[model samples]
Target chain A: MPDAIDFWFSTGSTYTYLTVSRLEQVEAATGMRFNWRPFSVRAIMRVQNNSPFANKPVKMGYMWRDIERRAGLYGLPVKVPAPYPLQEFDRANRVALLGLEEGWGKPYIVASYRRWFVDGQEPGMEPNLSASLREVGQDPARVVGQAQSDRIGGVYGAATDEARRLGVFGSPTFAVKGELFWGDDRLDDAICWLKHGRLVA
Target chain B: MPDAIDFWFSTGSTYTYLTVSRLEQVEAATGMRFNWRPFSVRAIMRVQNNSPFANKPVKMGYMWRDIERRAGLYGLPVKVPAPYPLQEFDRANRVALLGLEEGWGKPYIVASYRRWFVDGQEPGMEPNLSASLREVGQDPARVVGQAQSDRIGGVYGAATDEARRLGVFGSPTFAVKGELFWGDDRLDDAICWLKHGRLVA
Candidate 1:
């Protein structure tokens, strides 16, 4: 069996969006299977006792520039959406939970993140989400409604609970064989752990 | 007058240690004066929504291993001290405040960080603190007592409040002319901002 990587992600997370396009290529190269685990960014933020984007102006300004730089480096198109942090994550995350149940988790996560980060679309907006799902040949209304169901809500909650248990306080977190790696920058290390069964200590 | 780089740091922060040492050399080379501002790592962490080391095992592990790797790159000796968070930052921060008052803040921060991160000493431990202070010909007992006094304690509080107002949420944060650069990795950018008056946008 290929090594399984539990990918904890948030829909509105730019870093998570940055990593998604390349992740499948990484999995293919390393022969690792990514288990998509979508969770609420709000839930994780609550546990960490932080307000999203709190006390950050210049750093936030720098982040946009840095993201553009990184996106260019990766050959990805960058878009800066208005009302940053994009409060539409809830709807996006819900659809992600449905995708996980439908066994199309990877493609759904990739599409949703790309739509928000690269395509510059609001995640919770019905028209954009519908278009994204239609493009993927998944029924948008059904998927969105399913995402609102009690069962789908449970999945999202469970993922957040697991994130807390694993000591994950941020997005783009990766766990391989119970060892956690935080930040998009540490994706290579996570891959190394999967390939080698441990990090170089 | 040289551009003032406000350095917001914490005593037990390893990255801050590396930055402090390297920054001193940078100042000497480039001719700049740093207004060293010591603040509570706890407050910064809280504002950033990060868990203290005590609560996040994976983060704690990553931090230790990452610091070790970075220290090796910098040729700095380091040890993960007992009681990882080191609660006595209150006292250590007070001494730093005194150093600021005496106009010896730069060297004092550099020396103190070197003693902790480079020498593998517990910064909060009395013996280690005394040794570090005595090396600088400072009276540790008197400084410690004064640090606990209302006057100095108020100064530390004010610094933390100022950090919050400045949108600082982490250690090794540098603000140049109201532009903030966070993390040890951003020191170069901070210097660039000081010199160029803006980042390459």
Candidate 2:
């Protein structure tokens, strides 16, 4: 087992927003540090041929409603700034990758989600993405230039491929030892499992 | 929404086993009474053309492992009495309907899960189903006879149809007012939502 939980997340995953926003609080509460991994869920879902909420209006509707309720419970807001299930997440995710190497990655991810879901700014688009990067004190031009580099692409693709190999069917997965716990709902369990050895007899 | 939470569940659903086993304990802890409605998730999933774990070995693997961990968390056991994703749940569900009408429904459901997941007994099988009915102090032959009647079939079908109409995409969902919360993970959120209106501004 790893010393830290590997939090596999996606740039466009609605629930990943919750995990990013709550990361600091959860760390403080549980005394556990997470290895924040930014990966391409769209590429993963493509391989699986599964789009859980795409073209499924009822499930999509439930997802939005569930997010709103969860955000409320977590003391957050959902402005729903831009259209969801957004397609162009590569830029945002790459920028997140760049931010990570420079120690601004976590806050950049949180700021991006706040822009997309809380602050009425479209994510992965011009101006909004740059503004989110700047909020965490990174020079947008410098960070984004590096983010769009071939080097960033290599690491980003590697993370997604690794996620697939781990049998991670969805975003916001927690992986430790040989066990994979998918979805934000299992976050607590993952933490406990990491600490208590599955709590089974 | 309704005065009490409508706990829509399927007898064969793996997660529903957790909900059924936890029902009384949850009610006692939260002081919330549940309106248990026995419905066919197989019928609902068929209408959606979805079998989330069918032919999806990875997800199915995660589910059983997750259930075992949860059973451990809740101090229960998964004896794996019979093959999972059992196909013949209609007989067991019909008996549940009959049990409910005679005020033994809740315990019957719990006993049935205990038999299926805890004890080494196959659900919907001859001796097991009869033994479950008798555990609730009901006449196995008489209850199963009435359960097999046209009226039970009618109500059973109606509940399944109602679940479909309610946009219930999965089993072990909690429906409150006009909102629907899916999965056992949302069970706590559903209760909190019922008690305190969403907890958001």
Candidate 3:
């Protein structure tokens, strides 16, 4: 059942927070499964020479307000102006990859997003990340250390490369039968496609 | 009722076609009014030094796919790779302004979008624009001529400036009570805001 959908996301993305935090409720309500496919969306953005929010004040302003409105519509709690643009995501993403392997990734991702988006903590940052790891019943030292191993590093890179090859241009994209559905707003659309497929009416 | 909602659009924007072509059905279903506000979104982008699709082939690739899926979801027929980045939009935009003034703006906008998106025609280009004008009972020679005058130019410029002031960064925005809602997918969200306001649990 978990193989039915591919949920592609990056740990540092603002909108990915929405998807990661809400997927549990979505899973419960619909009885559908999501294979959490965490990858580095920022790496792909760099390769494409696209930095949508960098040095764009007006767009940034719009994004925060847009996210706020969407959070309300989704009945999710979020703190706008959440410390953004985390300097380092390597450790966080690798840990996410490791957790997915160990079957604790879901809770870790959700808790981290809650801290970053609901508690106004900077994503992929210290004390915060360590705390998030602990919240999911994982030892901070052991998991964080194992997350940096070369094996996990290799796995993470492969996932990112695979996402890039799949024509995924951003975080929080859903893939069904290899077709990419981008953005959180398209969650239901992805589900609709999963059930009925396209070309209706 | 037309005064209740402000519909902001640029003739050449790809996604505006979705809103313009489907708005009549939306109006009929809801019995609400939309004040057509035609403006040059490109002018604002020029000032901001921002171009999402320019020089980014990969992003453009993703965008085309996204639009195709969305068109399917909305039940709107669209031609992928419709002539884009229209070279001269000034004349066509002025004509839209004139149509709005003469109360023919709705059909004129809808017809133009159908030509551009469904028929694979370049937006704001002659023959296409002229035919669009004729489709809605306006003379091509007279309306097209009057559309280029200085008075129309001033009105167009003011509308563009007003959109910029209102923090509109994209086309086909729905503005209600001076609050901005960007993107075609946000139309329902905008209407929800209009009817019930925000912060619903």
Candidate 4:
């Protein structure tokens, strides 16, 4: 079997920012391929009823500080978006699906993550999404128009279902074989698993 | 100021079991004091409406596997109790308060955690609670009786309120100064923060 890891995230996920920032380095170090998959985190949260950011004020305060602290440690710049979560991830994910298929997923996804997080821009907005597409050398008009089609919507829905099937409750989930490792911290463990099979005592 | 970290947990918390398992080594290494405080995690979860174990089936499955995986990595054995989350943590917390006050807090708390998670025993039961107290060199009847008093109940209530005021949302939260590091994964970070203060880079 080929050595591959599934990289699952949503455009709006905070922890995903941390994972995406250093993902290329991890890939290079492990000499492994990453299946960059984007899905709707809001849908998963809605089903789970666990949006601590919006519900728990105390956790929300700590999370912002934790993100900044972690980002600094990783040597990456992060600025929390103006309106957090930017619930309209459908438009951005639609284009992301196309990008993943077209071999520009890495750059397109990273740039869009920067747009939403580092630059504090809204990915759901046309100018923001189109700019990311343009940077990845894709025709902005063609990609944007194609993303709005029913076919892309169907593909996006299927991807969310796949995430649920794969037991992904949170973002930045890394999966090797059938074992799932959730959150940014587990990236190292997942990479280790990829490099050297299951952990044995 | 004394170099101390607030060790926060509920008797029924799974992740807290992981932290309590290795807490002594961390204390020995850092030469830091831990203020072991037990509170009702169920009450906090109710306020947040984020109980994935009970609400989200997928998450609950993943959590068990994750906990077991982490426990193995930490060189600690874990056995899931008959009924997870043991809703009645009042009995355990009451006696735990007395344990903390009497300075046998570390052994008392670790024994109680082993009873619940490793031995698959209930903490709220008289037989189980009494056994833990006796193992810690305390008179079972006296400690049990003292734990049932109105004063201890009041003290336990105040501790939960203090946890809320300190912005603690989850079990196994290690707090130093005003920074809150939540979850078992954060224990290392909290210890590092204690040993080296805050990260500036």
Query: What fraction of the correct interface contacts does each predicted structure contain?
Result: 0.05, 0.51, 0.49, 0.44
Every model's DockQ: 0.13, 0.43, 0.53, 0.49
The candidate that wins on lDDT is 3
Per-residue lDDT of candidate 4, residues A141-188 (tens digit): 898888888988898989999998888888889989789999998887
**Residue A85 C-alpha lDDT in model 3:** 85
For model 4, what is the alpha-carbon lDDT of residue A51?
67
Q: Candidate 4, after superposition: displacement of residue A98 in Å?
A: 0.6
Give the least accurate 10-residue stretch of model 3 chain B, judged by summed lDDT: B192-201
lDDT of 4 at B63: 79
Candidate 3 Cα outliers beyond 4 Å, as residue runs: A1-3, A199-201, B1-3, B199-201
Q: What does candidate 2's lDDT look like per residue over A81-136, in tens digits?
A: 23677656898788787788889989888888888886656677766788887788
B132-177 per-residue lDDT for model 4 (tens digits): 8889899988888899999998988888898888878888788887
Give the worst 10-residue stretch by lDDT in candidate 1 chain B.
B50-59
RMSD of each: 5.5, 2.8, 1.8, 2.1
Alpha carbon lDDT of each predicted model: 0.72, 0.81, 0.83, 0.80
Comparing 2 with 3 on DockQ, the higher-scoring candidate is 3
What is the Å distance of residue A62 in model 2 from its true position? Answer: 1.4
- Model 1 over residues B1-201: C-alpha lDDT tens digits? 467788898887756767877776778987877778888867766656644455655556667766665555566666754335665777778888887797665666677677676565567565677887777777878877777899998999999988978877678888887677778866766777788765442
Please identify model 2 stretches exceeding 4 Å from their true place: A1-3, A80-82, A199-201, B1-3, B80-82, B119-121, B139-141, B199-201
Give the top-scoring candidate (DockQ): 3
* lDDT for B104 (candidate 2): 96
Clash numbers, per candidate: 0, 1, 0, 0
**What value does the TM-score of chain B take for model 3?**
0.93
Candidate order by TM-score, decreasing, is 3, 4, 2, 1
Per-residue error (Å), model 4, residue A147: 1.1
Q: Please, what are the lDDT tens digits per residue for candidate 3 over residues B113-168?
A: 78877787765677688899889988898987899898999999999999999988
